[model samples]
Target: MRIDAHHHVWQIARGDYGWRTPQLAPIYRDFGVEDLAPLLAAAGIGGTILVQAAPSEAETDFLLQVAAASETIRGVVGWTDFDAPDAAARIDELAEQPLLVGLRPMVQDLADDDWLLRPHLAAPLAAMARHGLVFDALVLPRHLPRLIRLCRRHPELAVVLDHCAKPPLKGGDLSSWRADIAELAQSPNVVCKISGLATEAAPGWTVADLRRAVDHVRDCYGAARLLWGSDWPVVNLAGDYALWFAAADALFADLADAERAAVFGGNAARVYLRRRGRGGSRR
Candidate 1:
């Protein structure tokens, strides 16, 4: 039941990836399930939650198609026009597909730091709450205050923070991010993903470079509220899948067996997959 709760797949030919430029050469090419299956196999990962790479309904539909075809993809965190007038209807339509486990509005890429607290997004968020969809917050540290407010505003919505809010590991400052993370964790409804940290560190970062942040997240959220993810291809920007996975394993090696299972797989299943009865096969 080992689950890599956050990862992505994209076809560069689709032209929707504005961020996938030549500068990110390590992962700029097309990456589908075929590219990831062996990596998951070698890591003993049984399933993954395929997430959206582009901010388009078409891309969401594309991810749904990929999830529908792949057994290993246990769930999908697709995109939708959360501010659209018809957002509720759009969410209802997507929810009919069953494999659509959650929705993510690329909040990190948006310029407004308080975008999560915008008045207009309330109705759409209510729609998501009604549909039992998780809100994957793709945010940065600056967005955390608004995120805390949003969680307080919608206590029913299951929100998960992606990439530890893209911490400033490279900047060597954990004080601010640590304080904010503790505040956000106060909400019983919010959870944090232990993924994508390596990519935020200094080039060729060792596991030691990631220890403080990882340890802090564990201390704040504990095993029950934490989940593991690979962030895959994007992880290639800092290191490869094997490197990050090994680092994560070493970081949590001291936990008791049950707690370790919850962090690595059970929490993701209970948060994302079990709600949809989409429990996938074990490796």
Candidate 2:
């Protein structure tokens, strides 16, 4: 089953998604599964993993409700205070819902400097593994060492590196980013999103420009360790789901259909261990 493992849902009227600013106003309006359903169908995508963008627990419950009703949204990556002493108990409560595949800590805006590896963060990290939820790291390349340490400490947690660690591709200094990614990929526990590179590259970026960033991740992590994300409303900052998926087609062209299948969908099934929509096949 082909799964777009990462995408977000939000309602502009809902006082959430503060990242939607005037700069992003063009597409910064309301976007929900209704808007994306036909697009996913057009792309031949079987389902998607609805990721949380709201910075609140209320939003997590709302997302869960949304997932329960949307057949195409097969999984969800919600948010939680991983450092909260009650986090494990909270996650246990959430675990009753099977579609809650993981949690994201908003690594892009954290203040811990080395937050991912702090000793104080250990209990929640351990809690994630104990509860069988993945940790989706929304980080920049500079956070690689912190992530490596944290992942080593909790090796059982399935940690996904979102946005190819969101490289500074447009600026073209990939040396440190490349090195860090290669190091992180060495850990079998880590998987990467082979999505959102167009936004990481300069706006108005050509197919070739976007391909460079995709190639770097593919080369470093290999297709088996990489997965796809539409990024939906977020990807709209550069392009829509259709445009981003088009870029992926051009970039993933070198691989055999089977290999591309892994990056496009197979790896997603393995990560969350979802039943592929195609004949109940298991990864």
> Best-fitting candidate, measured by TM-score?
1
**Each model's number of backbone clashes?**
0, 0
Q: Give the per-residue lDDT digits (tens) of candidate 2, residues 1-283.
A: 7888898888878787776776886567777889888998899998788889977888888898898888787788999877777877887787667778888989888876688876777777777777777789999888988898888888888899998888887877888888888888888899998766878888788888876677878888897889988888788778777888988888888899898999888888778654223221321
Q: Cα RMSD to native, each candidate?
A: 1.5, 2.5
Error of 1 at 194 (Å): 0.5
Please state the error at residue 248 of candidate 1 in Å: 0.2
Model 1: residues with Cα > 4 Å off, grouped in runs: 279-283
> If candidate 1 were superposed on the true structure by all CA atoms, what would the RMSD be?
1.5
How close to the true structure is residue 100 of candidate 2, measured as C-alpha lDDT? 81
Off by over 4 Å in 2: 274-283
Q: What does candidate 1's lDDT look like per residue over 1-283, in tens digits?
A: 8999999999999999998899989988999999999999999988899999899999989998898898798889999988788888888888887888899999988887878888988888888888889999999998898899999999999999999998899866778889999999999999999999998999989989999899999999999999999999899988899999999999999999999999999999999975555555421
